[model samples]
Target: MHIVITGAAGFLGQRLVTRLLERGRLDDQTIRRLTLLDQIEAPVPDADGVEIVAQALDVTVPGALDEVLASGPDVIYHLAAVVSSAAEADLDLGMRVNFDATRALIEGCRQHELAATRLLMASSVAAYGGELPEVLDDMTALQPQNSYGAQKAMCELLINDYSRRGLVDGRVLRLPTIVIRPGRPNAAASSFASSILREPLNGEDAVCPVPTDLEMFVMSPGKVVEALIHGAEVPGERWAPFRAFMLPGITVSVAEMLETLREVAGDAAVARVRHEPDARVTAIVSSWPARFDTAKARRLGFEGDGNFREIIEAFVDERP
Candidate 1:
């Protein structure tokens, strides 16, 4: 299998690459080549048999993916995007990178005649908003309230249509807010989700921009990468009629996350978190439904973290 991963430089992207390399296969086929694409050069892993190709190119530019597509990748993980807050801050950049680049990549697959190439995209729960039910299910409608969500919702529909037309075998995973991401925060409105736990555990000060009671559906980085691989491996017959659904996640409030941190690390770690509200962050995150009925994902063999404490413990155990 020739697998390609965009946004290969990001946290999730890097983890996915490492996991894939460790397994050395996907869809039960041996991975012979792994192509990593990002706006900046992605790290080239030292693999024994696999041909590793790393390229730094902007997907928004015309024909940017043509060369990569010409190589005929059997599987593609579309993880690149202008994240939530960044997209909301700049509409054009969001549309170009999120929506347009995705469309072009789909078209590139079609133009190259790579029929039924397994293309799995990382979408967000932000795709749901505006008068939502107490708990969201697979059948819930997408009524995005932010630019990033709107763009992702658009791509979901496009990929589904293209899949129906037999242009590609596509799957979209509506990811929950990924928690306890390592390293410094990025521009995502939900960056605080990771920051609160990540910084405090490191004995550094962190800010909570939303109310302690504000709830969010969150998944750990490890489970997310697992779901991406599982989504790709599931047969297309099962995904017919609809190709997108939310991944299972635990719903927890900011206070709960801090409490878990306190249990795992110490009271001092929790004390490092300061409650400083940011209206913009609150508005965007609060609009998303925190609770979900992910029966569909569960039935499809996807699993989530047991609880916030388990998530924190896993991060602590794994962090270098």
Candidate 2:
């Protein structure tokens, strides 16, 4: 099967591509080609048996996806987005890139009869909004507080609608804040989860945007890819329960993360973190769902999460 990954250069995208290469297809020669399209060109992984192509793709612009769908990939992972913080800052750009661009691609594929391609859109936990609860059901109504969350919520509806109309076979997995991301910081508000560990490893002090008590729904990069893969492979009838599932890791407060840091990297590493909470940051963080009962994900064979300590240790190992 030929596979296409949009935002293939981004954090989760890059990692998922590596996972795909390492774990070859179950069906022989099923995934012999991979096309990665992103605004910034992704480094196509070199493998003996797979053909990989990396291209410059701007999903927000006109005529971008038209040329892409012409190749008719068997599966498409539409993972591109501007992220939460930036989306909140620039409403128009956020709506265009995060919301409109995604819808456009869905419509484009539908019109060209390419919607049969399995589409795995990387939606976010941001889709759930207002005050969070201890547990969120698969059928919970999306009450997004911010524009980014609202946009994600909107896309989920579209994804379901297109699927119902038989225009596409798709699933939207609302991802938790991914931890242990490598390289530079991103526009995602959750980028701080990794930044706190990353900068400290580089011997630089990192700023904490919220109080140490702030809590968040977190997941490892390993788990993020697993969710994506599972969403793609589930049987169609069993997929309705998975149209949207919260893929979250261990829920913990900022204080718990810092404590874990100290246990793994020592008090000095923990000391490198300084706090100066921004009100806007607090409001945004507070509004997000920090914990969830991932019963649906568990029943579907998803795994990868524990204490924040394990997460911090994993982050240290993955990045170093």
Candidate 3:
């Protein structure tokens, strides 16, 4: 099987690539070629007998999707996006990259392949917004309050339409905020969720931009990857009516997260996090639903982290 991964340079994308390489197969088919495409070339895993191609190119550029899809990939994992804060700050850039690029990818898949290609898109919980239920569920309507969320909602609709038209076999996994992310923080407003734990354990002070009691729905990197793969492998008949849905996650307040960090890594590690609130970050995160009824995803075999302590321990154990 030939597979393509956009945003291959990103934190989650990179890890997904590594995990697929370790497994060496997908849906009982041997992965003969793996194409990793991003704005910058990401590291390639050392998997013997699997041909790896790493390309750096802007997905919005003319013919970019055509070039990436030239191999007629059997499956595509579309993880590229302008994150929450960045997308809200730059409307034109976000629309071009997130919306336009996604449309182009779908068109490329339709035109280039003789058969319907399997597409697994990485969506965000940002797709939910104002006037939400105390707990969101499969029946919950999308009411995006930010540009990032609006774009994802739009993409999900388009993916569903394309699937109905038999253009591509698409699956959209609306993921929760992944906590205890490795490496330094980036532009995401939710970056603090990971930084507060990651930086502290690494002996560096980190800022908590939101209030201590602010709640968030979160999952671990491992579980998110597992959900992604499961979304890819599951039979199409299993997804009725729509191909998009939210994944399961744990809802925890910031204070509880800190306590878990302290229990797993010590009080010194917890002390390294200092609260310095940012209104803009707070506005975006506060608008998102912190609890979800993901029974549909759970029934389909998607999983979340067991607890915040397990998430903390996993981050520390896997730290580079």
Tell me each candidate's TM-score.
0.97, 0.92, 0.96
Q: lDDT of candidate 2 vs native?
A: 0.80
> Higher-lDDT candidate among 2 and 3?
3
Give per-residue CA lDDT, model 1, range 117-220, as digits (tens): 99989899988988888988999999998888999999999999999999998889999989879989887788999999999888899999999999999999
Q: Give the winner by lDDT.
A: 1
Best by TM-score: 1
The local lDDT score (0 to 100) that residue 134 gets in candidate 1 is: 90
Q: Tell me how many clashing residue pairs each candidate has.
A: 0, 1, 0
Q: Which ten residues in a row have the lowest lDDT in candidate 1?
A: 234-243
Residue 180, candidate 1: alpha-carbon lDDT: 79
Candidate-wise lDDT, in order: 0.92, 0.80, 0.88
Taking all chains together, the TM-score of candidate 2 against the true structure is 0.92
Output the better candidate (1/3) by lDDT: 1
Candidate 3 structure lDDT: 0.88
Task: Tell how far residue 222 is off in model 2, in angstroms.
Answer: 1.4
